[model samples]
Target: MSQLSETTDGHLLKAITDACDGRIIQMPGPMAVTGVYPERSPPFKTIKLKGIEEFLLASARIGNRQPIILKLTPMDAVDYEAIEIESNKITQFEALEKHLVDHLGGYFNLLLGEAGADGLDAPYIASGHSLNAAITIFRREVEPLLARIKATRLAKAEQAAALAYADNDDWGTW
Candidate 1:
């Protein structure tokens, strides 16, 4: 445990180092959208997602380790909602992508296109705040394993090709 390490934060540091084996990465999440969306200019949209405490402490070798990523969203309310849908709609992590293509896709379409044009007709969600959790997954440890697999496969193929060439040369005269 190195003191004054940049990666070392309070609880997150102890959580990562005090354990018996493996590596850990921990960071805070941005939980609020503080910017304003002006009308008649850029498309008006903002988002607030939750944070997750991830662990990659699998004791297996680099070839067998499985990285773990997890998050815990707070149970809080929101400041605004669509005029048509309920005001208190809470969002969740339905997909494991880099963006919110699943959670806010439909609402965004309505807000920027038809809903605004049709004179504010809300559907599933109307004007209310909601809490949501966000998560992104990665496997830096397993990547080496994958590379080893590919290398093994390629070597086998090359060996077979060499054997075939040798057999042809030896049998050509017979």
Candidate 2:
């Protein structure tokens, strides 16, 4: 591998670890509550490690690859819930986008809006692409990959639930 690729991998690894640990950093944008943007009086965000790492490992085409846009679908909070519902929760994809913009701030920009048909909540520059082209590629490529990632996430969640609550039929004495 080239030195540049190695360096990038190292950096990405660090970001992934930080995100997994739930250490999030906020970026500068819309700090006013004008009935606009998702979060009022600015934005609150984090990184989505699982979905992102999986994407880099699986999708990203190496060799002369410029950064592509990384638009993320709003996460489903209750899709894999095994306990009481979390009324306020964002998905891993949302977190991953935030991480990208924070850690790689110079290379990306975060745009917040309602997640429409594509379920895209946060859109950030993964590389350098025009808006139209980015949207086209995202619709054609990233969306499908995200669906797969979500499926895997759900499966993993189910496994976690089984591990945590399996064969526990009686709650007798603390």
Candidate 3:
């Protein structure tokens, strides 16, 4: 799971930065270019975060002449960096995440409807658009059981509120 998460996080950032057509870089303090990046070269070389920000500012100023791509992976401590690059990029994840969300919402309501009518429990994959809908779907299912999860968390968080405090935690009582 950690590997998958790391891969996804790194891939997503790399994909976003690449699609943005920005240069990826790594630099040290004082704005000194300690590491000269290939400037958007493929198989992008990863580096620190501060450097990616620097490269982004530099690329943006030059009208980006080329596409800008920059990616950052959060590391330990207060310091982490991005695996940077430069290229012609596009926005896809925003749209994909939205689609995935909508699908989940539709099914969430469907599951609620089915569970209410029938007693069989089948599984389905939700993916479409609209994040709120996906959240709504998730809120529909398992949310009732969420109190158990939250209760575990709030066991020492001051006092226990009316169920869990998830902003949208309106799933009645357990």
Using all chains and alpha carbons, the TM-scores for the candidates as numbered come to 0.22, 0.25, 0.22
TM-score of 3: 0.22
Q: Roughly what TM-score does model 2 have, to 2 decimal places?
A: 0.25
lDDT of 2 by residue, 73-118 (tens): 2233322111110101212234544443344332212111211223
Give the residue spans of candidate 3 off by over 4 A.
Answer: 1-92, 117-133, 136-141, 145-174
lDDT of 3 by residue, 49-113 (tens): 44334333221111134323334322323232333333222122354344334444444444345
What does the lDDT read for residue 24 in candidate 3?
A: 33
lDDT winner between 1 and 3, please give it: 3
Listed per candidate, the RMSD to the true structure in angstroms reads: 21.7, 20.4, 16.3
Q: Rate residue 42 of model 1 by lDDT.
A: 45
Q: Which candidate is the best by TM-score?
A: 2
Query: What's the lDDT for all of these models?
Result: 0.29, 0.32, 0.36
Model 1 misplaced regions, further than 4 Å: 1-138, 169-174
**lDDT leaderboard ranking:** 3, 2, 1
Candidate 2: segments with Cα more than 4 A from true spot? 1-126, 166-174
TM-score of 1: 0.22
